[model samples]
Every structure is written in structure tokens, then in C-alpha cells.
Target: MSQRNYRAAIVGTGAIAHAHAQALLGSGRAELVAVADVDARRAAEFAGKYGGPSTHAGLDDLLREEQVDVVHLCTPPQLHAPLAIACLEAGVTALVEKPPTLSLAEFDAVIEAERRSTAHVATVLQHRFGAGALRLRRLQEAGELGRPLLATCNTQWYRDEAYYAVPWRGTWESEGGGPTMGHGIHQFDLLFSVLGPWREVTAVAARQARPVDTEDVSLALVTFENGAVATIVNSVVSPRQTSQLRFDYERATVEVEHLYGYTDDDWTVTPAPGQEGVSELWAEGRTTTSSGHDGWLAAVFDALDRGEAPPVTAEDTRRTMEFIAALYASAFTGERVQAGQIAADSPFARRMDGTGAPWEKVRNP
Candidate 1:
């Protein structure tokens, strides 16, 4: 594919939208032709800050006015599915942020929309694009890391009441399932990329610290199809915060420790006895900075240029979302949930909280 510039637009002007705008501007792969938000002023401000692209009060107006080849859905979780569907239907590819939708059913709807249109939709699982992560995946696939036996993923960060003051921060009906669905999902997505499909999960969740309808902290034990086991933790109450993932393979233990994003320096490889050369092999790869929206945008633009579906495809994103659904189902019903257990008709398929809002009872008391 020849190197050609594609016109792009951002659909929401929130805090994360700036990251999207800067990434698009920095990549030189796409031109930020426009921005849209419910607030016309916010859209204008975003345009002014990021090269003065056209601005509109809503996405529909932007879509109608601009010749956008790609649309970034930076809106809240609830709006992700519908807006993405709209973009794909109009023959424009969509790149959505994490917690792509409110439920598994909604994600399926986005997939259906993609199938009906020529354009494709991709979710933002940026951690999978980092050079360290890419190299680790390559090593594992080549059997250089041996077999992945056990792993731990933790997204333990701090979020106070003031952060939840946003209307959609804590509700199951809007923001999905708190940190498990929102914050830690980035780390878990990276874990899934390395470990592959999960088989079953058992979990427990609670609204221990924050006054919200979703769990502020949750823990789950997951069994993978490859016979590997993992313990996953998502929390927003920790005073000492970190986003960490540790994988214990037969020959070496690979770990990445960083708060938001990670570079090569943040990764550590400790080989077992007689495997001293593993560290040198781990460092044998192209070096790039920590993965973020910029890396993801580069991939998305390349895929578009090649006329192929981008990275973090709907099928891949569904596995992560299904794992999330299984976690919520297991946490709420006190049962082991399988990967395919949550179907379109299942209670958890409709909402992350499942059939009841257990947190509601505690909040009322």
C-alpha cells in the first residue's frame, strides 16, 4: 500500500480525546480533519488545541459535514456501541476506547454492524502493541519461554470520590463494572494476548471503599484453555498504586511493572537456573517506547492503508469481553463461569451486574 494520508475525526472531547488527537497528529499517518462533542465549546477547544480541525456539536453533524475515513469513538462506554455502529454503517472505520460497550450483547451488535458494512471496527487494547509485549508474545509463540504455567495480573490504582463525580463513572447502566471493566481491562487484555483463551473463572467483587453501584475491587481465578492458571485483581482503593503483570513460564519469569504504560525498561526477565542466556534473548528485538494510543493508531492506519481489518479486531475483543462477563457472572452468582456460558439470552449478557444489583442493597443500608 502506498503511503497516503487518511482523514480522521474524534467523536468525543473528553480527557482521553486529547490523547487520541495528539497521537493522530504525531503519527503523520492521518489528518485530524474534525472533532465532535455534545458541547460545541469543548469540540472547538479540542480543535484549537490540536491543529484547528473542524468542530461540531455532535457526531452526526461531523459525519455529515466531513469526509472522514476513520472515526475514533472516545465517548463514554454506553455510547461506544451505537456510535461505532453508526460509523461503520456509513462506511467509515471505527476505533473505540476500552470497555468498548456496556455488555456482551452490545459488543455482538457492533460485530453484526461490521459484518453488514465494508468498514471494520476495532477496540483500543494498546498494551498489546508495545515492543516489549510484542517481543514477549513472539518468544512465547516460538517456545523460547517454555510453557506459561501461572500468571498474575493486577490493576490496582487509586480513584477517589471526586473522580466518580462524573455522572457515568460508577453505574453499571453507564460505565459498565468499575475498575474490572474499565481500568484493569488494559492489563487483562495484554494478559489474554499472551496466555490465549480462558476456559473458566471464579471471582468475588465488592464495593468496599467507593460509594458506587459497581465493584471498586474484584478478584478472579481463571483457568486457560492451554492449562495455565491465573489470578486477576482489579482495584481502585489502593493507596500504593501499580499496574503489573507477572508470567511464570517453565524457563523464565517475565514481569512488567508500570502505573499507566510501560517501556522496555519497565520489564524484567528472571531466568531459572541453567537458563541464564534467556535475558539476552529477551532483549533481542526492535526497541520502541511504551505502547499507548500512538502505537495503536499506527497499526490502525497501516491496516486501513492495506485494506484489511485493524488490530484488536472484534473477535479478539469479544474474548476479553466474554472473560469480563464470566468474571461478573461468577462473582455475583457464586458459581464457576465458563468462557461461552454467557450467551445472548443470559442475564449477564445484558448487563455486567447480571440479574441483580447486589451493591444497591449495601448502598441503601
Candidate 2:
């Protein structure tokens, strides 16, 4: 494998960009050499904090000037695809933030661009990189944990009015859907990583509180291809915040609870009668690395060095993104959406609320 160091750049120096910048620096194989944001002053500030790499007004200018190996897209949901496509065109890997695109249509466009480019696009669903998550996948595949029977993925956090006061926080055109797209997507992505593929989803979405254009809360019942069922809840109104996922296997029950990110310490396994052997499997190959941008970046760099596609590849990201679209489609249409049911022309594909969010109709009426 190659041992060459990589040049890295970051676009959109928002709050999430800080994590990307730090992760790039921590990777040891990559350097933060450039950054771009529409706000020149903010870009400059971000540059100053992170070894003062060059700052540009936008990705186009940054691309023209810097020859980077990877560009981290820390911009909002809408900008993720365009910025990533630009990176792909430049033959630079794009590490995009969650809700990789505003809609399935946009994500497909990015995927098409990727097919035509030499570089790749990776979504930053960092929770899947934790040591515990890795161990879980390994054990499950090795048949130590038995078949998955049921699961629950809940991302319940509090976001007040002030949080949505930001111009783009809660809008469909800007931030996409509410908690389901933004807050809980990490949990959703991590769940998909464990559960394999989903068959169908029945969901309901609502704007229970917080004045926003999108639903602040959503609940879904999903059936997986493996014959397992799961419940998912995404909300931003709960005062006591937590991100939790529980998987019930035939042999043992595994769970992880935390907010934002998690490590091995956050995971616990409860074995079924005579299934205590699974604990040993879970304990093997444990690492101190917590689930976060840093670990994900490390994996990306490793894949790049090995001349292989990185984790959270287009197929992986598309499945999770499709599930998000399916959740919204099911909620908006009051129908159970099957996998591969959403076509390019589907309203949900054109936009998250292609059929229009129910609450938006009531508000306008």
C-alpha cells in the first residue's frame, strides 16, 4: 500500500467543519492545506485556527489554487452534492457531512458525477467507525451473536426555538427534513450498517413543536431483508437528550447509548440464556478510538492508501439516504414504502417533501 501523505481541504467552515479540520490534522496521513466558505471572514478565522491554510471565497477558487487529495464538505445539506461533484470533477475525494444531499435526485446526480470521475464520495456518518460498532459487525457476520430479531434506533434531542432561529435550520429547501434528516441520521446510518438491508418502512412525521417548515419529530416501523423488524424515532423536542440503539439477536441483546458519538465503553451486551459466550466475541479487538470524524477519516485514508473504495461508499450512503427518503415518503403519503420503490421522478426524489409536508399545507391554509 502507498504511504504517501495526502493534501486535504475543507469547504464551509461551519461548526461541523471544526470537527473535520481537527480530524484531518489528527489523521497523520493528511494535512489541512486549504479552506473555503462564502463568508470570507469566517473562512479566514477557520484558517487561522488550523495552521492557517489558504482561504478562499468558495470551492471553485480553492480548487483552482490548491491540489488536494481530499475535500471535506462541511456545508449544509443542499450544498453537499454540488460541492462533492466539484471535488469529483477535480479528482479529489469528497468527505461529505450527513444528509449528503437535499434529495434523492441530487444524490443520484452526485453518484453519476462520481461514476464519471476518478475520485470518490464518502459520507461522514462517523458512528459506524467506533470500535464497538466494528466488533458488532464482525461478531454478527461470524455468527457469534446469532440472527438479529429486533431493534430500536432513537435519536431524541432538544432543540429550542433559538436553535431553529438560524435561517436554514429547519427548512426543507435548506436543511432538508427536520430531525430525521439532520439529527438522527447518524443513528439511522449506524443502524443500517448493522441491519444489512431494509425491505419496507411505515412512518409518520409531524411538526409537534418548534416553529419550522419540516417535521420536528418522526417515527417509523421498518422491516429488514433479514426478517428483522425495528422501530425508529427521531425527535428534537425531548429535554433529556440521548442517542440509543438496541439490537436483539437470537443469542444476545446488544445496545449502545450515548449522544453525538460513542466508544467501546458506551456499548453493553446482554446475553440470552446460555449465550454468554458472545460477550467474549464482543470484547475481542477492542480499540480506544471513539466514534467520530477522526476515526472515519483514518478509515478513509487507509482505504485510499490501499487503492480501495472508502467506507460509506456510494452504495452504502445511497441505501441510508434512500431509507431517509423512504421514511419521508411513507410519512407524507401515509403508505408503506418498499425498498427500490422511489424512482427518480418520485416527488420524494425531486425533494424530501415532493408531495408537500402535511403541516406545511395546514400552515398555508
Give me the candidate number with maximum lDDT.
1
RMSD of 1: 1.2
Report every candidate's CA lDDT: 0.92, 0.91
- Residues 97-125 of candidate 2 have per-residue lDDT tens digits of 88899988899999999999999999989
Please provide, for model 1 over 62-129, each residue's C-alpha lDDT reduced to its tens digit, 9 standing for 90 to 100: 88889999899999999999999999989999999998999999999999999999999999989999
Among residues 3 or more apart in sequence or in different chains, the pairs in candidate 2 whose N, CA or C atoms overlap within 3 Å are none
Stretches of candidate 1 off by over 4 Å are 286-288, 362-365
Instruction: For candidate 2, report its TM-score.
Output: 0.98
Instruction: Assess the local accuracy of residue 158 in candidate 1 as a C-alpha lDDT between 0 and 100.
Output: 98
Poorly placed runs, candidate 2 (over 4 Å): none
TM-score for each of the candidates: 0.98, 0.98
lDDT of 1: 0.92
Candidate 1 residue pairs that clash: none
Model 2 score (lDDT): 0.91
